[model samples]
Target: MILGYFFILGNTNCTAQSLPFLPDELTQVLESGLPKTLPSPAETGRFKKLPAGDGFVWLAESTATLKKGNKLAFSKTFDAPLKEDDVGFVAVRCRIVDADNNANEPRPGRVLIHIGDRETLRQTALYHKGTIGREWGWYFHPFRAARSLAANTGRIRLSFDVQPQRVEIEDVRLYVAPSGFDMSRLPMMEAGYQGREPDAPWRQGADARIAKYRTAPLIVRVLDPHGSTIQQADVRIRMRRHAFGFGSTFQVRLVDDISPDAIRYRQTFEELFHALVPVPALIPQHTPHAKDGNYANQLLSDLTNTLHWAHDRRLPMRG
Candidate 1:
């Protein structure tokens, strides 16, 4: 079927996929069809309802009829092979009944999930219901596959471990992650200002210190089998400029433009990096106060312009 143009199909009521830009390889992986599960009501069974069905069986729990641990556990196995360039995610649906409810406030226990053997606190999903009631409310958690398991070759296993708190779980499921999955932020290192300026006051010879490292060549050596150096090795070097500057989130740039009078100075990263527009002007401002903030308004304007410039070319900022 032709994309971006209306076309008629043989009464099949075909609808265009939401993400038409997905890579063809990834699209093929999705088109392979998802594993089928029966619809609700018709799909009801002992295992479907939980605690009874063998299908949604518990893998581990803190306390059981025989022995109690600090938490409850459940797991399911499925065959979903992943190929290169294919992204994956997991969606889990279950109900959690926390035993600790004080005056309608739930000090619900935590739920941990593991896709395959890779697990981290980032994969945690909550099981607390706000009201003090006996209704078994369902919670749906979606997780993106970690880089290690994004591509795979074997049965996919999803395991859930709940911290000790009087809790009961039901209606557990594991499946391929779908688009628009709300994955939590992966662990990240905060960016920092690293250059002579930030250290100038404390560094006795800051310029010399900066030059010492700046002038150091990123050397590449060529050698032969006997460990003899190749004297005339042709080499080409491409180096990125070392920079020290503050970076802000794109959301901060969405504010209304600042008054021109608030700007103290204007500068551009022009040569340091490719820019789509004039760099924002710098203004003197302080914490929680935009009036006296430095570059407070200019930064916003610059970001907005930069976004427009990139959008015009249909290019992403990272790209």
Candidate 2:
């Protein structure tokens, strides 16, 4: 993530993504947006919803067992919809608003999008990092139109892949490339031709040279909105990619957990390591440790060797 890649999803239109208004809290959590261009679930029926959040937002999906499944679909409700913007990412929140922990299986969740004819989904896994008092951040693939599902009023669905999980989601948002603002318009557009997939993302050669010894090479440094540093927090990412059908993963040691109370984590397997936070820090804004809600956004930004990546498609860090 770069300075620009990081825009409060719910708060601003940093990345040219087409999204509905973002609720205040969500912007307090993650930055950037992901989009979906999938099939028109509206073809079946209208979008579904139940009372939630101040007035209305889809109910978060919850499963009774990590074994069973729960899902809900929402229809396009924009009084007036936007056009063919290219989506790069979708950002949303998820947490065990309520839970009956029969197992440590991470509660499952998602940020799903439906276009007229196709569908793109950003799957959420159990919490890998971050505090429970605040919603954890998850980034999925950008909304794609390449193999996109068509239409305006499609479906927005969420599901619980496993059971014994009750998750809450809010501040659904997106990162889009307005349908007509074709990057082809950029004078340097020819340099970005080799698109990327989720798994084996392109790593610049020089960046590879810089990461010569590490097993995973891309390292980013996150700064707070006021431009302060977050010290010693672990950095991890779950991103949906276009190269492969599913998505990709990346991680690095950010900081040591100071509190003895531990957060059980479901590890991710990232083979094409593209980024890391050379220095990860956090300003613990709360009390008796985990109970505090006082904290700043996890300063996260992307580290890239654009020059090299522009020439190659690889995650330079993985040895």
Candidate 3:
């Protein structure tokens, strides 16, 4: 399968331009305000610090093979103190290779981030292309530390838990943003793969299928009371609902509630959805006290009221 990757920074004002490609070891840090040097993991057969020829460094694992459930980790005090409520974003540029070259699919790994004593974030590291000679890909994970950080000072730890296949790691870096910083606005690299091409054979087939199945002809005829077609007339069509359902599960208790917030909730639900599924209140497990006469009667009353409310508004409900 053909595979490629592109780095996309979400900057609305800047014009699009091509960026020069750099080797994995020399990948530039895209975000500003990052520390000059991040603390590196100690050298080992499975993990080592490699120099980039420039002053920069790379934490790499190139020698020993890893097995499932194997853990590799390191800790370091930040160059500066980390304050409470600060947001941390970690960017890792790495790749995994199938050391045995016998696997049918990509392997998966987990990366965990710890600030002080509490585990702050956990993200999956999917080795989508694990074959030999595959290019490296970048992954970004973000987390926030809300509690007090007086004890840990600037200390942080990172752990990589291996899956069923052997893997390699090329680099890891952390950037600390101010509290309430929006992670979605950060620059990110977009990943591309074979089937995503606009003119791919599979895409052409999909387009043809969509055109054949998802479209229909609509003809309008305006008629008079005498059963004759009107030559000059205005015909307007307004769609009330979609042929496809768009909805979500809603709490049944909210249907009978008279509080202002509940009223707004029900109104918004009706405005947005053409159908819904009543949640826990109608589920069998939630009615465990069915043997109690009074409890059963109350539940039946609430359910009946909810059904009436839905019927009055012409809302279709599933259970």
Best by lDDT: 3
91: Cα error in model 3, Å = 3.3
Model 2 RMSD, rounded to 1 decimal: 21.3
Candidate 1: TM-score? Answer: 0.30
For model 1, how does the per-residue alpha-carbon lDDT over 99-177 read when each residue is reduced to its tens digit? Answer: 3334233333334444442233232221121111123332333233432233332233322233323433433343343
Per-residue lDDT for 1-319 in model 3, tens only? 1122353211111111322232232212123222355434422224544444553433334233354323455444444434544555555555444332353433233344554532432221111221111335545544444333542344445554323333344545556665455543454344334334455457877888878997788998888999899997988898887787777777676777777767998889988887877765577734535234444565666777777887887778886
The TM-score values for the models, in the order shown, are 0.30, 0.31, 0.40
Total backbone clashes of model 2?
Answer: 59
Ranking by lDDT: 3, 1, 2
lDDT of the structure predicted as candidate 1 = 0.34
- Give the per-residue lDDT digits (tens) of candidate 2, residues 272-303: 33332222222132112422221212222211
- In candidate 3, stretches whose alpha carbon ends up further than 4 angstroms from where it belongs are 1-84, 93-143, 153-170, 177-195, 200-205, 208-219, 229-241, 245-319
Q: Give the candidate order by descending TM-score.
A: 3, 2, 1
